[model samples]
Target: MFKHLLPRLRERSIAAKRPVSLADMMEEFWREPFASLAPVFRDGGYPAVDVSETEGVVTVRAELPGLEPADVSISVENDALILRGEKKFEGEEKKDDYHRIERAYGSFSRLIPLPGKVKEAEAKARFDKGVLTVTLPRDAAEAARNIPIEGA
Candidate 1:
């Protein structure tokens, strides 16, 4: 159904272009807000992330391909987890045989807020197989404060 409708839509667009009025141009402009935002999406940035919590600990995993351990930094401050990294495209700088290029480069930072205070000293991070994982242990006292209240 959509395949047959597409040609009619294109024909209508062509006919509509004949005497483009101010209202028609305004309608076209309002219809596509992302056309001017293509450059922002093209910039390689912000690696994907996944976070999980178990018991008193939270584990965060991020996918960072083509990045080394030294290129990444993790920090926690005021219950906020911060992950920052820079991905550099490293290959021979030759002027030949380049088909397509679609990878993000430069620095990206992701900050995740924890629900409660965590044990900073027990936090650990490891990177393996292009995946970075951080383990955060919650503070024992804060983790045990949620006692169920009985009906009065």
Candidate 2:
């Protein structure tokens, strides 16, 4: 989706001090739409996630239905938050009877890039119901600040 790469293109444009044309953006989209997303989609994007920031804390929430807290592992590595887990659901078995199972099962790992540096040691995680929430306090020095314009 173009929306997913808009921010990246904008950042690149700013860094290069040049405007990114629509054609350029489209070229990038066409070149590799699935370059980074192939793995995620291939695995069904399990445990769908939502990342948000509030005040000085960055929160990552993931939907992990049918998974127990013990079955999941959370870690921050290589400037990314890594979530790894397995989902296992066994179908009922009756003597000499075949049953069709229509549920997803297997292992999955999701890597989410951090917007800025975070206090990894101070991070906290909570799992309630079928959701997993991780809160990481932003490193003050790495937090975003507005730049003042010099000319009118």
Candidate 3:
């Protein structure tokens, strides 16, 4: 039960857009019958995303601090951009707890909806300064075009 749930809970909470408290979590644990199976969003999500479309391309920038290229994976599947990665907490030693511990480490996955058709083989990804930028070149046929306003 809890053995498999803790990880999921942590991931969901981290993915949440707003902060969730311990009491809230406890209340959810007791009241929500589907809590275990539900996706929870608490706040301070991982790998925050910024997406934009311009110049025949869709750009996705995700912040992945403390992660290496090998720790992340990006792929295109059926008009969707999938991002998968894991953030590990390296080393744990006994420490005096007088303050606060807020950093979270775990696996995260986000599926972004594509703005247009993309050439998967022509896509490019680069990682620098803990940020992963993926650019998907849009298909020529699917590129956006401006419509000139015609006054009659």
Candidate 4:
């Protein structure tokens, strides 16, 4: 009995050293192939977005790494704020020996819808240390509008 159990324990130990079984790999392969190829945004590959509203001003913050100030473009159209940029990779690599690669390199765009109309001339943006912060102040006349509702 003891000898039989020893063989079984050794088999289990050997199985643990192996990478993965074929059945497991096939199950994962069929599950979601694009899951591994998904784009990584800031904040663990999820787009970093934050919005704050003051008495009359709204602030938006986004994190964009590996980008220069000139590489980023911000535009407001139809009350939607668009942030677009490209994170480029310009490193020399040997064709024969590339062990691993995990960093993301490509263009990314983030669209943020403003809660209220903003003054385009008064909007401000600053990028520092991979973080971009945008401040949009609302127009005073537009901010003061209070639509009265008639009872239906």
lDDT of each: 0.78, 0.85, 0.82, 0.77
Model 2: ten consecutive residues of lowest lDDT: 92-101
lDDT of 1 by residue, 46-70 (tens): 6677878887788888888878899
On residues 1-152, what C-alpha lDDT tens digit does candidate 3 reach at each position?
65566666666677884325564477567876565663455333456889998878899999898999999999999899988999898777678553756677888988888987999999999999999999999999877689999999
Model 4 C-alpha lDDT per residue in residues 1-152, reported as the tens digit of each score: 55556555556556886414454445456876655555442524324779888988889888887788998899998887888888888786777586776877888787888987899899999998988899999877766566899997
Once fitted onto the true fold, the runs of candidate 3 whose alpha carbons sit more than 4 angstroms away are: 1-45, 95-100, 144-152
Error of 3 at 112 (Å): 0.8
Model 3: per-residue Cα lDDT at residue 5: 65
Best by the lDDT measure: 2
Best by TM-score: 4
lDDT of 1: 0.78
Instruction: Point out the higher-scoring one by lDDT: 3 or 4.
Output: 3
Taking all chains together, each candidate's TM-score versus the true structure is 0.65, 0.64, 0.63, 0.67
> Which residue pairs of candidate 3 clash?
16-41, 16-42, 18-42
